[model samples]
Target: MPSGRRGRATWLGVLGIGLIVALLAVAWLQVRQAALLRQAVEVADDDAVLLVYQAETEYLRLRDEWSRSSDPRRVLDAPALQLRYDIWVSRVGLLHNERIGNALATDTGFAETLQRIDRFIRRADAVFAAPDGPGPTRVALQELEPELMSLGAEIHGLSLRAAHRVGEQIAARNATVQSHNLVGIGLTVSLSALTLAFALLALRQMRQLDRRRAALEDLAEHLRSARRDAEAASEAKSAFLANMSHEIRTPFHGLLGMLSLLRDTGLNQQQVGYLRTAAESADHLLAILNDILDMSQLESGRMVLSPAPVELRALLRDVEALMRPQAHAKALALHIGTDPALPERVLCDATRVKQVLFNLLSNAIKFSDHGAIVLDVQARDNEAMAELVFVVSDQGIGIDEATLGTLFRRFAQGDSSRSRRHGGTGLGLEISRNLARLMGGDITVTSKPGEGSSFSFRMPLRPVQAVPAPRTLPGDAPPPPRPLRVLIAEDHVVNRQYMAALLERLGHDAVFATNGREAVEAMRAAEGKPFDIVLMDLHMPEMDGIAATRAIRALPDAAAATVPIVALTADAFTETRDRCLVAGMNDFLTKPVSPPKLAASLRRFFGSTGGADFAPEPAAPEPAAAGGESPPLVDTAAVALALQAMPRERLAAMVHSFLDQGPQLVQRLRAAVRDAQPLELRVNAHAARGAALNLGLAALAATAETLHEGASHLPAHEIARHVQRFADLLPATRAAAIAAGLPLPAGAAV
Candidate 1:
């Protein structure tokens, strides 16, 4: 097409050049011809006729002079007469001038007259010759007189004829000039016409160019529109997926909870096995749902990472424990190895990292029927960054080359036929890869036909100075142990039943509210009843957990306002957790809750009073000295940990400071309860609780936690009783501090 355009342009150039050259050539020729005609007119209009007139007049004057001389009575001076004759003869000779010659050439009579004049001059010149040659005499003068006189008429006639011929020549030259002017005018008009045509063609070509430019702009606009349309569709798809995920998972969580409850119901062995399998299938389906939701979040750029310092070794240990059962179920060996060079704590989103690892390990286990799957961790350094590399290698039915290619692509499975046998949504790997990238890491796989596949996740590892101690395993430090009056606020029947069964097993009295509204009403109606905790389901119909919590806190009766509120929901989003916290809820729990987790929540609120299952091992009773001295109330180890959290002087100040303000805090709590301001009571109680805990005042801290928890729901009289108890303990706590050897401020006393 470009060549064709160039060819067209070349033709236009040739045609334009050719036309201009033709016009220029015509103009140049006309100018040259006109210049020639002008030159001819100038030549034809020369002074020949004027010269002829002068010569003829001189002839007449000579004849008159000679005729006068012919008077015999006059004393004719020969020399003087001869002088006049010679002058006349000179005039006659000038007839031979070029202009005169050309003028007379076309005049037959003018030439003859010029010849007659020349003869007369010749004859008369003999008398006017030099003294040595001749002298003018009377007879000679008389003879020449008649001839000179006759020649006068002839010369006059010749002059008249020359003037007429000059007029005709001037007329002819004017006609020739008119012809050249006409030719020049015609050539100029033709040139103007061609110029107008060329301009019109150029103008038309410019319009076409403008049209093409507009077309290109339109095409660009169309592409932008198409891109925008595609983006909108993608955004819509993301929204739909998020909504659908929430809807499906909410009920799905209830189903899982029901399954947990069903297991407790005594049943036949076959029924138990079927139920377990059904539960596992449901769990798998939920997992697939989660994977789909993750993919949607990632594809829409809605996923966010919250990174914190994580203990790498502990994280691997947790991974091993979780994967061991599945490995054992399949009779496969699972090995996890960590290099000594790895950092104790690295900055990462621990949950997401675990998730990616879990996905990879799960796939490894599922694909491998019997062989071992090994997870190895090590520190790797590149030019730009340091990384923690985790490699999960499996030996079993090896992945084929073709299957490995799409292993990480969304909705892609290795073998179509095996998808049913090993069901999955096929988005796990894709989600894992996206998550890795979000945290400045990547997941890659290498596999060969009939050989093992190795999947590696590498993340940029940032070391942290404050390495948190290894997390205390469950049972090593049991959950908060305590049973208490519990309020279950849930809308789903199955979920409510599950909570009932679980709460009954935990040896706690349980009351029910169908939704947030009923829950609030139940608390209000309790009328100082001892409801230890409120499990507020977030997705209730009448009012959500946040709103209900707010309403409860604002209740006029302080006892009914400051109840311990725990948000329960199926939402696993960070935003939802934040919403729960921001709404004045004391704790948050994701649904499909286990007995241990529920017990933990209860223990967190009721502490030692709740039960031993969740209670921290009681601080050993202070031992008496060797001499049977009084025992110290404070633990030295707990005090040392406190000192590490603050300077010794600050710790002492805080301990003394809390004792000094103890009375005032108690008074405020009482006043808040009397005034029905649960927020104020909760705040004061929370402050006291924190300070008391920090100072190792276990009894005071425990009392404050109760006040903080029950300020709204515990009766005003009961709250006052707790307050009086708190005041009485101050003196005892001071005595214990002195016994523990902690120095008191000056002027302070037990």
Candidate 2:
């Protein structure tokens, strides 16, 4: 319960307890008063006065009887005279009763009057005792009558005194009762007022509670509305970013292609220098664009890490290779080191890790004109988990506390003046930190003005067993001795012209198709001499590359159906690549493609490579590891060998066909497990393993191999688990294949 309500309930309980106690006290007081009133009434019963009056009347009757006996005219009624005497004595005795005596005790004459009556009763009893013997009771009765008559006056006086005393007592009791009634009335009024106040307080509390409840509900609704608005705004931002990426990259590709073509136009020395500057600016712009796209992906939670076992030394070597040129240009020393205890192989996403290191080193080289930049790698144990720490310390103009606070904020730099001198998007550090955090790590910086800066990047240490590097096809081999036929599909006129010129320079026969549909038609019509390879553009008016590839793969003629279809697009999203591959495209190449990149792709498909004069593409840095239990999705080396042995289109068909059978394979595996048929499970697993191995679906192949090996002795549930793992790998393998350009080279799986 809420604290306010809980406190109110406790307060109410205390009030209720107090009210009950007050009521009990009032009841007790009322009961006590009632008992006192009853005792007063019992004490003032007027019984003493009644007894005294009866004695006086009996005295008068006795006196009369005695007078008659003394007259001697009525023949002396002895029995009647004796009865009167006895009755008088009895009445007088009643006056002597303890209750009556106590009531009359306050009167001084009461005791004397009772004594005199006792004397008369004693004398009369003697005469009445002899009633059955003689009639000598007349003289005795006459004697007792005189005393009894005299006692009447005393008895009357006692009665008067007793009545006066009772009256006084009754008056006093009335006064007491009146006072008690007043006190009871006052108490009752106070209690009523107290009860009314409590009721009012309770009512007010209820009203407050109702108001609070309404306020809380309103606040909750406002928060919910705010959350909805935020979500909508976030979705809009993501959409805008995606659209901008596609729009900008599509045009940017043509611009870069034209620049590259212009560079080789036999220019003078001054023109060549201008071209170099322009190329540098273009490269910088491209870097900024890539950073923006990466930031967007991070914000939208779409940046996925592809982790695998990587050689630690090889990865560091790649970083050094990329940064050494920049460092040398600035005349700065770059030193990279690692602890001896560090493992040879660690799991991580090599590309992102390299991206971060590259940014840090580049910044160091950019800022420092003198001194050295040091990058040290070490393993540190933190409680239960081990961590791999990379510290990049640079002898550059450092940052102040004020600038350090916002250093990792987007678009924020160390110093405004220095930031102008060193041009950047100011998103590199932020992107690096985000990437680090995404990999269960963080990047922290320590800097002091006029000194230097040290950036420490830490991530969980996960060691993996080192495996022998896969053998790759030779890159130094001579190019094709003869020219080959190549088809280009594109909608943009500039891009189509650029491609035609690039092919002509490479000494290859080039055929042009305006769109994907035209490309498919061209392939179908090429019965006499089919095209060697088709370079397909992804976006076109008539048909997209994905659809066209699917159409070509479904052709009736075997040779036409097995034509290699390579997707060339400006969109670099992983999802787009996966779609192209799943539609049976042989490979994917992001646009702004240089001559060397094109030459390399051609050399892989056909055994023709004569573009050796062009500069080679830079070797990509090894990615760091992400946490996963399965092997890599695709074995690039295997795929390369497969492409060498068979046509590219045939391998794509085999890969697609294998992926299509995922559901059926899952069903068969399930049935085998359900029926406890190990042989059937083994047969199915073996079949899957063979196909996956041929297609270079490494994760699927590994899963299938596990099932095939364990089917005989493994528990049913364990076998089922492996089958489920196999099922899950199908889509991931397809996506990985696409991201890695489908038929990738050795160690090129994404």
Candidate 3:
């Protein structure tokens, strides 16, 4: 039952009991009032009878006195007798009004009694008014006595009936009160029992609630302790990882630095080759460590993705640019294709996406020797989901089913041999998969052992609706041209000669600097005819390419500081490229310096529309006359003719001036190479590359490039070979110039 209904029922029962008590009390009071009325009537009836008897006695006495004396005194006695009669009549009248008429009007006996009283009173009055003086007391007495006696009897009957009815009513009220008291006692006992039961139930509920609350508090305390423990564990793990990374990096940095310093110490061919391999291993180790650190940070949720609108075309171009060199080295064909439906721009984390692409492309290049790598991008609209997908597939040594299963598993490599041959920490695929998932996408692989492998990357790429296409800079937009002043900074004399020869043939006026520092110095020193572009070497002893670039950028003069600087290096790592950019270099051109890469670098700074149209650089000048003798090896006139072929008289003048300075430059290059001073070797090589390039001596410039690259690790004897080669070429080069109607300067060998 509902509590409210129960309470209402209890209140109604109490109200009913109250009403019953009130009614019973009223009944008892009524019975008592009836009893009093009946008693009063009986008393009145008795009083009337007594008064009648007294009047009768008095009347009889008065009558006797009247009969005994008829004198005047007798008349006075009669009047007094009449007064007593009047008193008796008044008493009778009171009896009738008080008892017979008012108290018992409804009762026949009581009415008869009232009538009898009235009759008796009438007789008394008549006697009192009689003139015979109390003549016959017997006459008045006789009439009143009968009437009064009859009234008394009637009054007695009426009083007995009223008293009986009142007594019966009182008995009924008393019985009712007793029954009511019994019922009230029962109700009180029942109420007490109910209150006790309710108290017990309430106490039980309170106890149960207390138990539950205690249990909850205990659970809360345990949970708080567990949470604190988990937090402490997590913090400890982060601290350990940070410490480990720092410790590893410190030693690794020293190792790389020592390796760098080792290059300056002269080493034989075998040692040089071993050192190169070791350096490569060190680099790979560093890469793996970095990748692991990156993965750990990413898993810890410490790294945040930076999304930006990126041009897919430009991104692909960069990817191709990065991977092309690797493919060339491996003798592999790389194919990149995209659907025209692909969006111009996509919303993505450019850095992460680029990283993924680089990893994929690098892996493909690593595994493939002669096969092709195909990068496919498609934009498809499906009814369920509209998105663009990118896939990169390669015709490399494929993975088996078992290997593919664990392809993206952490720290899992496809094969032990593969890991040994092609070193990797195996975190790349795992990280890539995690990154893809974070981007609301995924990565998958399909491969067949001994056939080929295709790795596919699918991501939900949002179309960038409002991104503008990148505009080509004014310098890069124009067609290839020449007759421009080009600066070549190298450290090997032969390589410098080779570059100068190539530049002359390309119809570009070339200036020579032995090293990056000298290149910057030369540019600063020039009063007029400032070099338009600087071709910088990566590894020069005194001031490396990066440092020189920084120095040039910080120069006070605008012309020297703002000149375009391109790096010529053998290190093609992404980190190296980043370093170049950080150093304010305009571009990166890796060695062994090829004609196409060289032309491209030059074209980057010099607009194509209108420049010199020069002849091809002369191949190598004929070797010096037989066995270690005094033969003029180079044809200087031929070199001059090649320069003049560009139809630029100014370029010819530059060539002539360069030849005049050649002997002195050669002497300095020999001394630097003999001393095994990388910095000086770099300076001399750079000068020769420039001068040789200006004179169209392709062979000499190429040799100088070799000396430049190998300077740090190449032994003193090896360095001497490049110096001797450059020295032998000077005579033939001067001869070639003079033969082309460009006279050699005074004291110049011919």
Predicted structure with the largest TM-score when compared to the true one: 3
Q: Top model by lDDT, which number?
A: 2
* lDDT value, residue 605 of candidate 2: 63
lDDT of 1 by residue, 1-750 (tens): 699889978978988898888778777877777685775568663477777776776566666666667788887665445445544554555667676776678777866776776676677656665534546778888876667667767777877877888788778777878777777777777778777878978887898898699789889989999999999998898789878988999999999999999999999765886787678667756865776765656777887788998888778866765676577567565666667677778889877788889889988888886556788898999998999899999875668877777888878987667666888778779888988898888998888755778999998989888745689977696565556788988765445655665566567778998878988888888975758789988765668677888777667564565577888865557777656644557677764354556766665556444422432323446644676743234546545544433356555656676687777776677556544567787766665654454456777766776787897687554676677778878888877776666678777664
Clashes of each: 15, 12, 51
- Per-prediction RMSD in angstroms? 51.1, 46.6, 57.9
RMSD of 1: 51.1
Lowest lDDT block of 10, candidate 1: 609-618
For model 3 the TM-score comes to: 0.32
User: Which whole-number lDDT from 0 to 100 does residue 494 have in model 1?
Assistant: 43
After aligning candidate 2 to the native by TM-score, how far in Å is the CA of 676 from where it should be? 99
lDDT of 2 at 456: 95
Residue 215 of model 2: what lDDT?
85
Give TM-scores for every candidate, taking all chains together and pairing residue i with residue i: 0.29, 0.29, 0.32
Kindly report which residue stretches of model 3 are placed more than 4 angstroms away from their true locations once superposed: 1-310, 313-404, 407-534, 539-541, 546-565, 569-599, 602-648, 669-686, 698-729, 741-750
Summarize candidate 3's per-residue lDDT along 1-750 as a digit string, tens digits: 899879858866775576566556555655655564454444333343344444355445444543433333343454444434444443334444454344344556655555665666566567555433445354455555545444445544544665554555456666656655555565555556556655765786688798689789989999999999999997887677777887888899999999989988999665776687578557656755765654566677776778888999888866765575566456454656678678878999876676777777777777775556778888766666666666877766788888887888877887768677979877778887777777767778888977788777777768889745688887786444447787888876545655675576667778877777897788788646777888888776677787888788667565576577888765568878756755667678765454545665565455352434444434654655655544333435444454443344544455566665666776677556433357777756755664465455555666676777788887544666666677667666666655666564556444
